[model samples]
Target: MELKQLEYFIVVCEQGSFNRAAECLYTSQPNVSKVILSLERELGRPLFERSPRGLRITPYGRTVREYARVVLRHTAIIRSMADYGWGKKFSLATYPSNMIAHLLADFYTHWQERYVVEHYEGTVEEVSGLVARGQAELGIVYVAQRQLSSFRHILSHKKLVFQPLDVKEACIYVGPHHPYYVRDSIDFSQLSSQRFIGGVHDYFAVEHHLERVSLGAISTRDLNYAMHSNSDHVIISALLHTDLCSLGLNFMHQPYSHYDIKTLRINGCEPFLTIGCIRQEGEPHSEAADWFVEQFRQLL
Candidate 1:
């Protein structure tokens, strides 16, 4: 029932053993067990079941784990604020592509003196989940390839807002040895016979754009999968070594132009994606969050 009890429960769930949890909490195993027993008695359900290897969370325990994570994250945020004399620490979730491309570096560089910035990288769906659950103060994501309708629906229900920052194009690229490299412009029809490496899910813009190009129109069976990864670096690396073509944000390639690669213009398709920030609608943003947004706005 107590916050400390919830903390202990989470520790046990994560560590998977009473002894390990006790060591982590810096408390005696007996005390940890007693507290867990009391918590189970109050809840009237066993939170964990012991197995040969270690403790396993029960079905009910899984539900409790979600709430426990939220509570613990918020508690730590509160404690961090208090420890810093109420100064704000901005927690942001971003996609891997944005992080690798240094999109946030300028903002962080100029604002770190005034705000504490924390960054997390994941797929668009994962980032959305973090923002929805209040784990992150805000999230930056690409909107074109993801199912924005579903995100809109979920955010509307949760009283969250998604605001557009900028609209940018993504381009297709191949290594220097590819046939497309010798041409000033390559016909889109040529792609029908080529293997295209693309993002699979939650990358709404990329996926939707590819869908329009009839990704499945080309036979994947004969197509060599150069690589399938959520990380931009991995995809780029794959394209560098093989004749495979990849779609990427235009800005992502500008910095790496020195590398040996050829960019192909896909006629009839703009290949644009919108980048934006998402946050809870009514929740008050911390000072750090406000400053970070302000800096980002200036950059845009």
Candidate 2:
């Protein structure tokens, strides 16, 4: 019925006497006898034939003893593996996330050395789909407030779990060579006269906020769109060595080899996107997946 009961049974069979079995178990003879009786009653069979000479193991007793020993051995192996941090390989998905890139870099540097990490990159919806369809154990994706309703609908339809993370503020990145780089920060109106690069939506988000400020400049229409590309490397490279600037997440303001990224905050707004992690809702999964999520929560 229990590991201790099996242990007492084995000892009684080997020692042949209740007195000797109690000595081997370091307990009173009465306690040893009680445990064996309980085990025999729970099993619906007598494990030993009582005799004044000693105890004799029955055929059914041998069958249980062999299997019980095997169970204990397997349990020990499982505990050892858990104690040593032996975790299963986990597949993770994210939608072109620099946040996850930094988080993963920190994850590798900090703990759990034996885990195998598999990372996949895709569109935000695609990443969510991966977790929904059971292709990935976890996913990280970003959604602005306006898109939250629909995103939640999609996740619910797929039966996935999600928790929103910190908001990623939006900002404009400029090169060291740019004139505005000399100032500690630039005004909201400064963007109206500047040329920009990167996604049109990013520029418009900044422009919309600037319009609300109404510094007598109702039109961000004059703001030049010098370049438009989805590639961060290309935009960052051009911004670094050239006069062109790009709108980006505030966290993206990191230094490159030859230049440091400088950001200018808008006068009245902190334009931000909410990021969240998603996973299957009811699937049987590994503890390693939970551990990985904790690492992100602690660090990010």
Candidate 3:
């Protein structure tokens, strides 16, 4: 049996649906079913019982799945050992973000002497295309829940695997002197009462959702939308001297700790987004890229 076939079967068992299995496997439903059926034919037993909801693992399927894990794990080890990078250069395309930049720095500083690292920062669409076309070895991107389906649809078309590295909600950032700084969290609608400061390209992915939210804020006391620039320094400057509030990640406070910025979740509006490391499905990652992914994942 082919390696892909076994992978499909195992994933189908995990996800329970042909659709989800196909998505995780980066293939079509019928194709996934075909592979599983092929495996069943070879083994002379049904792996799953079909149903409207999804597939249920048969008793024999459980037995097959137990061994499949061992086989796939060993296969990965062999592949990594046998095809380890000799001199392959590594390229990574990622959307601009403070957390991602810091993580990349850690990896680059640790491996710079032994590996050459090429990094590209751009919009999610641009970097996804870059990695999809083989211009880069991997990609790091943040997809808000609203955009995830379309984003994954695009990646699936390009046959790229989406590996979520971290997940977090976007929080409000204000100076220490702000009245609400002492509060654990702020009501979502209360945001309308604060003057908003934002960056043209936010390192935090919250900007997209905030734009939609600000439309209905309709608060005369607080400035609805203030000027935003490409520079985070300018944005932070406004927050320090003015009553303007901006959106940011919780951990980002450390980088600007001297400025005394505080981060707070927006009640009823704090939706989480998945930050993922993407690579070409079924393709071998360069040793440098694999090492970086491992280290970054560990750091998270």
Candidate 4:
């Protein structure tokens, strides 16, 4: 199939409906349907099962979807590499964190008119892949100390190196109305009854363990997850409006004070995580990339 066909197919799979996918692609529904029909005819395999109720992706479609995503990601990497150092575009990927978001905000304010910032947020593995594939100049992520050896080994295979910025203590975030608001420290045992806003589980299974110990030695898998999301905004809203607490590092809570969020150290257990940036080994950081990281160094 053509690249456009694969792109359209992936979008349809994500949107789960021809009409919605058409809307997203800014095309007519009939046009999408025609493309899918042509694709199925060529492949001699149905991608979607049609029924009176709705469309369901077939087993073959699920496999194709994964392959299509990899193809698109690789294509993007190629395009990005071809355009590297050509303009003011400075791309960076990062794990979701309020601290990084705040640093980016301040960085943009100084160079908004002069530079083009392409910022992406995801899990640690996703961020590393972006840098490894040359799609991003650098990636910022934190790793649990216990997992650092394995994490670094994986990065080495990807031709990337992680440079530690700081070691952060595990902290729990609570809203102003939370009962723990007045407390300066909370033990993992005391958090058993607390509702948590956990991360959305996906392909990165290792992140679950990393996220669990981010607030110290608690059995977060057994803790009540009131809501799960990958969006920082959603997590912040949950913390502000609901009684949902979040597990993270102390530095990650840098901007939480502005929102009246309290950061309490986890007692009895201390999980030290190294916050750092990853870049392709032997590749010098671009001026903009260095400047972006320098801001973080100043903050940390």
Lowest lDDT sum, 10 consecutive residues, model 4, at 202-211
Residue 145 lDDT in candidate 3: 64
Cα-lDDT of candidate 2: 0.69
The residue pairs found clashing in candidate 3 are: none
List per-prediction Cα lDDT, in the order shown.
0.70, 0.69, 0.72, 0.80
RMSD each, Å = 5.5, 20.4, 15.8, 4.6
Instruction: Write the candidate numbers in order of decreasing TM-score.
Output: 4, 1, 3, 2
Cα lDDT for residue 188, model 2?
60
lDDT of 4 at 151: 89
Any idea what lDDT model 4 has?
A: 0.80
Q: Candidate 4 at residue 190, lDDT? A: 77
Report the lDDT tens digits of candidate 2 across residue range 1-300: 588998888788788888999998899999999999999999999999998777888999999889888887666645433432364557788754445666666656654566666677766667777787566788876666556777788789899877786676556678887788876566666776778875435322434334434343445565788887655567767778888886555554132223476776545445446667888887776776666677655544
| Global lDDT of model 1 | 0.70
The deviation in Å at residue 113 for candidate 2 is 3.6
lDDT of 4 by residue, 1-300 (tens): 798899889999999999999999999999999999888898899999999888999999999899999999888778765543434777899877787777778878887766677788888888998898777898988877777899899999999998999877667889976888888988767777888886666433323553455443556455677788989999988888888898777754444357878788877545467888999999977888888888887777
TM-score for each prediction?
A: 0.63, 0.54, 0.56, 0.77
lDDT, candidate 3, residue 248? Answer: 63
Better of 1 and 3 by TM-score: 1
Model 1 per-residue lDDT tens digits across residues 1-300? 799999999999988889999999999999999999999999999998977887889999999899989998888756643434443566788776532346466656766566555667777777777787676888877776345677678778877788877776555678875667676445555656666676645545464555444343333234345457766677667677777787655553354366776666665555357777889888887766666666555544
Deviating ranges (above 4 Å) for candidate 3: 1-88, 176-179, 199-207, 210-223, 232-242, 252-259
